[model samples]
Target: MAGEKRDFNTAAATWDQKTHRVRMANNVAQAILGALRPGPDTDVLELGSGTGLVTLALQPHVGSVTAIDSSPGMLAELEKKIAAQGITNVRTRCVDLEKDDLPGPFDLAASSMTFHHIRDTDRLIGRIFGILKPGGKIAIADLDSDEGRFHESNEGVFHFGFDRYLMRKSFEAAGFVSVRNRTAAIVTKPGPDGGVRTFTLFLMTGEKPARETEGQ
Candidate 1:
């Protein structure tokens, strides 16, 4: 975990310079927005909000956002962007999603491209379930399973990508219902061998069942 944080921190200064990264973030945010259709009263909690690209995109549609990331350097860049844009609805925290407790009971929880970094998806999904309010939704955008070519090196990656079926099963195990998954975007990047590689990004969503009332 320490090594992964260090790598991300080192990449923070130049993270936004990659056009593909920005485009992927935008596409992910769009997918989540379309699925969740957040209202002015929605309270969102974002996991792994590196550099706040999605956070900024989401702020306009929601009442408030609590963005969490493990990398301090990434959060620093996000804070800078938030200040520059005068975005008052978003707040940030540097905390590990795996080891730390999240602040929540949020109407929505979302994440993009960061799940592959975590070692345990099932446990994380359960944690997310606990933090959301009843009937809350979770929207996650991440890469589909690939032949391990996307990341040139797998130093920090826990899952090369994810299988949609397994992901949905995990969501169900975590007690989410009305689950749906679909392709959200496709990204082409230059491979190490000078070939173009296409990676598919998927959007998966599920909703926590609302609490039961005394009378039917």
Candidate 2:
């Protein structure tokens, strides 16, 4: 969390071996599908899509997916999976979505467990708004407000979870409408005290409203 560097590259090879992590991704994907009910015409852009856990889960439901992340190692692993499975619609990009220009105009944008690593949440949301088609939607799954104890070490964590009400405000500030959230998953991990701690995952969804036409 604070002192150590959490390298997804170093962890990529064995990432899917972690059963709980995989389960968490599946849960997040299910929650997103429940909220979005995307169609075959939906083009998806996923941010911080580590190893394509959530990306692959949602790939079958969408027209296409461009999964982006900052870790080359993680992307490599994802590439392996796509190649092995002959996945034709999902592609990967290794870049910082917060600063880089990506090919988009997507119908949906989604992420799982990646929001806490971002420092400027509102800016990213606004950027997504700009990249998305009007009436496009976003589904982000993350931990609820926790007092900095979710991670064992603070690698690149920017927030110790988030407040749903305030997060809805951020969505609105980015011109998103019909914002809503619900508990998506419950995970238990060994806390710093060596005991099991339960953490709640939330799936937050919102839609970008169609812009108004110029006044007549």
Candidate 3:
């Protein structure tokens, strides 16, 4: 996790800016949030909320949201945005996912542009499943593939993104059903030296079965 702590703070500062990179990332995030069929009673939990971008996007749709992230700086920015927007329904918490237990039984759980940062995919999925209520849904939006050499050079293991097929299987193994992966185009401009890149991200979604079938 080379500079993992630094990258998020930088992102939090420029989160509201309309740069191409920011726009692309937020687009994917927004798409993931949009997929959840939120209700008036829906209690949503968002993992890795940066600067309240996704939290603000989802607030109007759900009953309430508890946004969690590991970065204190990011959470500070989220607090500022929450106050400015006068959004009282959204609560921000700084939590270390690798160490802390996710609090829930939430009607739905969602993460955007965060899960790829985690290396232990199975444990992460299992934790999410543990907190979800029966028939609850989990939606994750992240890079489809982690193949860039830069990531390898920077972080020991860049997670290689997520495999759609493997993601579905993991969710199924965790007792979710109606699992599927939805792809959408995410446009990013070139850095100071590199060319522009357009990434196709997948929003993998699954639901916990209301009840197990007979004869299992």
Model 2 Cα lDDT, one tens digit per residue, 1-216: 464335779889998997879999999999988899997899999999999999999999989999999899999999999999999999999978657886689999998888888878898888888889989998988999878888776688888898999889999888889999999999988877889999999998999888744771
Worst 10 residues of 3 by lDDT: 149-158
Residue pairs with colliding backbones in model 3 are 146-160
Per-residue C-alpha lDDT of model 1 across residues 19-96, encoded as one tens digit per residue: 999999999888989987998999999999999989888999999999999999999999998888888999999989
Query: How many collisions between residues are there in candidate 1?
Result: 0
Residue 32 lDDT in candidate 2: 87
lDDT of each: 0.90, 0.89, 0.76
- Model 1 ranges off by over 4 Å: 1-6, 212-216
C-alpha TM-score for every candidate:
0.95, 0.94, 0.87
lDDT of 3 at 162: 71
Q: After superposition, how far is residue 177 of candidate 3 from its true place, in Å?
A: 0.6
Stretches of candidate 3 exceeding 4 Å from the true structure: 1-7, 149-153, 191-193, 212-216
TM-score, candidate 1, is: 0.95
Pull out the clashing pairs in model 1: none
Q: What shift in Å separates residue 109 of candidate 1 from its native position after superposition?
A: 0.4
